[model samples]
Target chain A: MNDFKIIDDVMPDVPPPVVGAVAEARARVFRPHRPHRLRLRFPVWAGGVVAAAATVAVIGTAVAVPLLGDGAGDRTGDGATATATALVDSPGAEEVLDAVADRLARREEPERANWRVETELIERWPFAGDEFLVENRDREVHWAGPDGPAVVEVSRVGTEPLTAADRAAWEQAGSPRLCGSDSDCENDQVPYGRTRYIPADPGDYHLSSVRLSPQELRELPQDPVELKEEILSRWARALKDIENSDTPPGGDVPSDGDAVWWVGQRLLTEAPTTPQTRAAVLRMLSTLPDVRITDGVRDIEGRAGLALTRDTGGPYAERIVVDRATGDPLAVEGMPTVPVPQLKGLPTGSAAFSKLIRRMGWTDEAPALPEGCTPRTKKDCLR
Target chain B: MITAPDEVSSITAPERFGVVFDTHYEEIRRYIGRRLDLDIAEDLAAETFLIAFRRRDRFDPARGSVRPWLYGIATNLVGRHRRAELRRYRALAKTGPPPDDDGHDQRVVDRVAAGVTVGRLSGALARLPRGERDAVLLAAYGGLTYDEIAEALGVAYGTVASRLSRARARLRDWLGVEL
Candidate 1:
């Protein structure tokens, strides 16, 4: 009847020898070692001597000039100098980002009482075996008024049919079409295609929601370094608050660097940015060593852009493609670099999730209902 | 001036680390060993000390004794092997307690009776949510007090109580035991 006693008794016993072995191994590996000045200095001097000798040899060989001013040696030196400078210079990603920042800063700010941000998010996952299911492709339009209540309109574009293998599996599992009648089959098969307008809670207009109020957007730091610090501190505080509430098992609180990068990405995509804020965000992103530049990236719309990719150091990898000419974000895609066990049969490097920004920015006009949509019966409301 | 016997005393970092290890290593190792296989527990136990050693400066003696902190580190390590822990519980549920080598006696008979309950308990523990299971196991097996369990799991005192209560209620219903 003693449940605790039974629980205790069932635990596998650990003998003393095992404990001794572990302790010994730990002490051997992790025990603090005293600093050895001689051991450290020997390597330093040796490296310095070798580097100096190599430099001397290179210079000596260069001194045997082929021409007067622009000799072979001078050319070699110049090439070497240029290569060295290239290492220290701004990378292509940074350069493109800077150009974009400049373009945004120079653009005239539109005078509007509200902003309408429209986005389409596609989520795909593997189900059964070899069967990829496009779970949801939802198009969302969020409107943020200057001083009034924000609103959101969500419409599902369509659900992609199960892959051949998945369809076979679904049929084998009784071919379930959970509906009231045969007439409901079409709607059940593709359950979402109607737009529903919802008034958003005023409290939802925070940085976490990726929607900043005009006042908040204006208050963002213009300086890149200050902005980076601000984002990190805010994210850290949020993470701390979450941890205080419930510590998820095996979940790591992201490091300050990861938080900064995430903040940068969110700002670029979600937050309402002014010219200064946009410039600061780009500048902040440029300072990140991990943001890689890739040329010749095409969005779903087949528009070419430069891609700024950063591995977020998880199962997921995120890439943001920007228009080469305009620097506006064309598409933001997050692909899994490793197999997601939770998704069953999904393989690595699958574009399981993506977000396409169909339209964004400030506008004076109120959001209008879709064509052929009546107020009472909102049917065929999705364009 | 003389210090009171019950008052906590400050010690040098190295000495403190050594004292903490010597005092708590066995209990910490046992805690991890119960959740995971003994082989992995050995390695994780050693790792817990290494982490504790590195983070010794952050350890505040005024807050609580070193035991709860050490157990917390061990519990965190256990959290990392959640899959393995769940698997162990499932395996235990499928296969009842390991065969007893000792000759049949009154004690052996009592143990055999207990084995049946343990098997059911294992199944119930496996079915319990991870957070609730962790709270239950820490209290039932790790011998952590409610406050200590809360500190170890990094949850509120009420959360620890609630999680344990929910887990025990589930177990009570499943096994039809009055516990």
Candidate 2:
């Protein structure tokens, strides 16, 4: 049997009329699609007027004096509605963020021995029909110094069958022992009590991984525009490397706006930044024209702070809450704003998650295991 | 494979999308058609072009040609209909050829012979793993070279070779012929 020829002959020729139909469909549906750049380039001055009118209407207060520009024309009623719908078009929000940025620039980085960051990550997986198994992991990460290797320790702090039905289903599935000596059991069957420590290597640092070396941090431009450009070039080069390498494609290529947002996230959370770099990052964030700062204090982990947010036009919207007094980032939250079609059965916006910055800044004390953690290996207890 | 010259210049040009659609539409349609029914293939092929047109700015021609990239998108669409594909192959294996419309004595004989070969081939294909099957079919029917297949599947070049080798070996064993 000719395998190649048989597979080749599986389909008959596509009828010629289908081609005409597709062409007509493309012309009718797709031909008129315009790039977002055209819409984004509308005059900022016009945006400012509309923003002021909308603010006055929504807040039920007299319009505050325009910060940067004067109200241009009599375009007020429908124009206000349009500006209100477009959440990121607020120039007042930009002004608030710029003030926050100026505050960050004057701030100083406190001296410490190591950088310690604590995070709580919760994950839910669907189990037997209409049930979910949830796991919460608590992680503590320490970098010995700005340029030093990182030591990461993660412990699964809690696990519960998501619902009563889920609990019953778990019992039916043999109430599988967790964190046992047996390697044969399913991962979820094992109890969530183990702590694993990963020792870092010097070469593991990279901009793509969001961990910057001290040298790299020091070299960053203090000027906001130059810093943004440097971040763009660095991130673009990193993406190109991934494309050329055999590694699987990473996430979608970040747009300029996305890159700016990511740099802010990195500085606040992962990047080992000097005080100057951190201040510059905040200043750069303030200058981003599209960023929208929410008015009123936001409470993250019971700590009240100002919120800076940007909608990525994807499944999740990101917001960073900063200490109102210190201008230091207190928490970064990603709440799902839309349903992710790829992950089936989850309700829309149901799987909201956040990464709270429990601790940050240098400490004179060395990294150590948490109390009550029984070391499974010698490396896990290494100082 | 010859890499296309950097098409970053044409990315934002909406008119260039028609050029891409017209050039590769037929081949992409047939590629999906072999793995699925004609009607679904037609719809999917059109959807593929729409997605490509929308994401034109993200396409970097420096990586590979537009052809493999289009095939990659088509392949992902096919992946979603995997059960239907396997069912089609199994059905072909169980049933012999459909009765011929244009009946001639010699043509009838040829159809029967072709049907027998196809039935056995489908049976063998149904037994192959999904990744291996994808590599084999793209190589056989889509006429993609090994490098092109690597780009299409977003895998290492060596991985493509290994998967295709294993798949071909299994096919040979299943067919009881040295091929």
RMSD of each: 17.7, 13.8
lDDT of 1 by residue, A1-383 (tens): 23355456544444555435534432322221223321211110100000101111111211110000000111110111101111112247546656777887687777587777687766553322223342446676767676533656766565443356655665664554411111112212112444545443343344431234567666888777787767765654654453343212221223344445545665666556766776677666655555566657665446677666655334444566777666666677755555554344444344545567777778887877556443233132333
Q: How good is chain A of candidate 1, measured by TM-score?
A: 0.60
**Residue range A47-137, candidate 2, lDDT tens digits:** 1101111110111221111111111122121211111222434446545555666776776777676776666543333332223343333
**Could you tally the backbone clashes for each prediction?**
0, 6
Candidate 1, pairs of clashing residues: none
TM-score, prediction 1: 0.45
Which of the numbered candidates is closest to the native, going by highest TM-score?
2
- Could you tell me the lDDT of residue A242 within candidate 2? 39
Alpha carbon lDDT at A102, candidate 1: 82
Deviation of model 1 at A266, angstroms: 2.4
Residue A382's lDDT within candidate 2 is 19
Q: In model 2, which runs have C-alpha deviations exceeding 4 angstroms?
A: A1-99, A124-129, A132-135, A144-146, A161-191, A209-212, A239-253, A297-302, A339-351, A368-383, B1-179
Look at candidate 1 and tell me the lDDT of residue A371. 61
Worst 10 residues of 1 chain A by lDDT: A43-52
